[model samples]
Target: MPKHKEYTILLLSRVTLKAHEFITKVVQSNSAFGPCPEYICKCGNIQSDICETATVAISSVYHQVFKTKTKFSGLEVLGFDKTIITDELLSDLPFRPYNFQLGILRIWIVKIGCSNEITTNLAGPGFKSAFIYQYNKSRALFFQEIDKNHCRVTIYYECNAYIDFIEQNPDLVWSKIGILQKYNRNQLFELTNQYTTNLIQAAQIPYCTLNEWNNKEIITNIYNYHLKCCIIANINWYQFFCNKFEQPNTIIELRSALQLIYPIEHEIGERKFRAWKAMLKNVGCSDITPYEKDQSNVLNNLIRACMHLWTQRISY
Candidate 1:
């Protein structure tokens, strides 16, 4: 049995003093409330126990924070919305299993109106710039304040399952073989390039000229396209290797071949022409065996296909 993963989001908001006061009253009133039965069942939890515990903890923190002082340094007030296990969030996850019997579930714990020391850390000039750089590198979703004092910050925590169902179950071999036969190298590359070009064109506007809505959509598209490209590349590589090794029918044979020549290494300064040269290297050499020569040919072709798609920068 594999351990279940938990995903969490902490949202921070800054509101007017009056608005904050009103929100505090509302949270206090619903201090003992739990998520409804529908949500509990949908989330696949046992009788809403986890949801109720989270709600109680959030309410307790809110009560403690608002009991004495009105002004706090960082995000001090907090509230829990609901534990959602919807298909929307699941579709956004990095991994989408195909033809495998692996169970991949995501439980989203969204905490609204939360406060932490991160706000205070962001106040420093150096930390602010560094944080922005890190945020951009992460490519996570970004939100801004609706008004003057209202802002939302969301943080996600994801856990991945480690069970190797592919090895445990031999019945899924046909499914993997089917995936390999579904797309060839050329077809995969063509589709990936077309999709990437569309995404690049849609985001061609100047960053400074983009409005809030446009910016959000562009960012989301960028992330989604990146994930799509990765998935396509993985499938393409699997198919490439399976074909390169003469289409191994059994899982054991496929696994052995992959273990021997799974990762095609690329040097930092290596040129595309150099890979071509290696592929055309004579098999008479004592250093390179016939098998190694064939591997080089496959590697050269794969690199050429990927480079051709990746270098295309279509402009509007």
Candidate 2:
């Protein structure tokens, strides 16, 4: 049997002290802490365990994919997209199998408008309009800002770390997602919840577990559903990786980066790329193959995609 290591994902919302205060005042009251989450009922470990410090100033997932090298190995990025809070827009940007990074940090709940209104942290279909009604007058101004320009609020969210978040932190705030069921709990959190619970069901609990619904079938879901996303998302993520913020997916990027590590002095013509590609495959990139030296469409597409997305990263 192949050796499989236990993996944990941590999702965090980064916010300045100012944004933090605003969110606590506005959305904090939105959720009432439920029962102590079972994942961590006896999980002695704390949030500090696996959750890392949030990096400052990130804009697009498109950007992060190309902006940097990862500090850690065996890690991969999921996918990227900005959030939409309004009712109609929310439907297009549903929360099922995905989530919104609420709280402050320039990104707050969906706003009513810039005239000074608050927004609810509601999920799914009603997420947008419902969020608007939840706002108070003091916050009405910001809502207008969101509505008028469609300015992006938060940076981005990833799939893997999201699950780690539940492992490290209580899924209390996350659990409220069930309420969105009326609107089709089709949001991404449902899978996340299941991922967390699956671990508990096995009784092979970790020292610390997230209170979020366990993803008992994380392996199945990830292999069947999430892997397709990662195959493209991660590869695209790597081609766009930034040398500053972080490297691209170490897991998959290694297949590309490792190319340089190998000796590549085969005939430098049509077979040159083929030779190099063969070397890479030997290392583990079974997906790679040789291409015409003049204008390799595959490699060209990869670079083009990476450049397009990396254009928006926050330069240090």
Candidate 3:
């Protein structure tokens, strides 16, 4: 393979190994706390905040090692969440793994929410009324993938749903942490494994055939057909739908709709969709609309029609 690819693989391996060691130490050191179920119960109920304990821990380590501020430290980076592992971030690391280039390893920090059933089971029916007992629980998953095919998932960190609960119920901190850690170590492993397996299966499926259409005329026909469906569905044509005209917002909405129709996984489909969008934007069509106005409700009927068409074409 290319030298850069080899270098990336080596760098990521080292980073993963170091990260594991650092997190393990942090968890082990902080795992001991006294118990107090009364204080935990006294906290009442509230929505669970996305626990930043793991993010903070990881960020602290990264900052110390790299001497650079990350998103967790007000770096203002856009990603899925605060604790994401991107290729750009991996490239910043200095270490290189020795003789480890079997395949490319990409690490992703995935946030998995606790199911209502599990939460209800844990807290019991009496505690179920509490908002904290609802869907407040979550776990941070360290998903490592090799060449997008082989994946290894592990629970990197666990946290109580309500941060205040941990604070007020200081004695029960270890118990609370232990609950999630134990559950995640056992039950959640199977859940994440199954989820990862499903993703792998989905990825193995061929890209939708709708993306193969290259003829502009056929594409335009499809667009018009959807427009007609929108009109038939009583969508306000002048107020909502974009036609062959100078409607920038409408064009943007149309592009978004196309994304839902042909997702990013469909590489050729995305290219074709963009090309189609550009064509509609620059080279205005006289055949579709009599006049143009501000775009609104562009998604309503258009989405319905597109989804209908998509469902007919693609099979899971």
Which number leads on lDDT? 3
Predicted candidate 2 versus true structure: per-residue lDDT over 1-316, tens digit per residue: 1123222211212223212210000001111553221100001121111112112112122124335443311111111123332332233221223224323212223312112111211111212211211122222211111222122111112322111111211133224322222332212222123432342233221111111113334322323332332232223222222321243432333334434433454222334434434333222223322443443223222322333443232211
Ranking by lDDT: 3, 1, 2
Candidate 3 whole-model C-alpha lDDT, 0 to 1 = 0.29
RMSD of 3: 22.5
Q: Candidate 3 residues 1-316, lDDT tens each? A: 1122110011101124233332211111122363211100001122112122434444555556556776342122123244554543443222222211112222221322222233212111111001111122453433221111112322333552223222111123324445334333222222234543343343332221222234445444545633433323333333322332233332234545544444366443434534443333322221123234333313222222333433232111
lDDT of 3 at 240: 22
Backbone clash pairs for candidate 1 read 75-115
TM-score versus the correct structure, for each prediction: 0.16, 0.17, 0.16
CA shift of 110, model 1, Å: 24
Worst lDDT window (10 residues) for model 3? 35-44
> Over 4 Å off in model 1, which ranges?
1-12, 15-60, 63-179, 186-194, 200-316
Each model's backbone clash number: 1, 56, 1
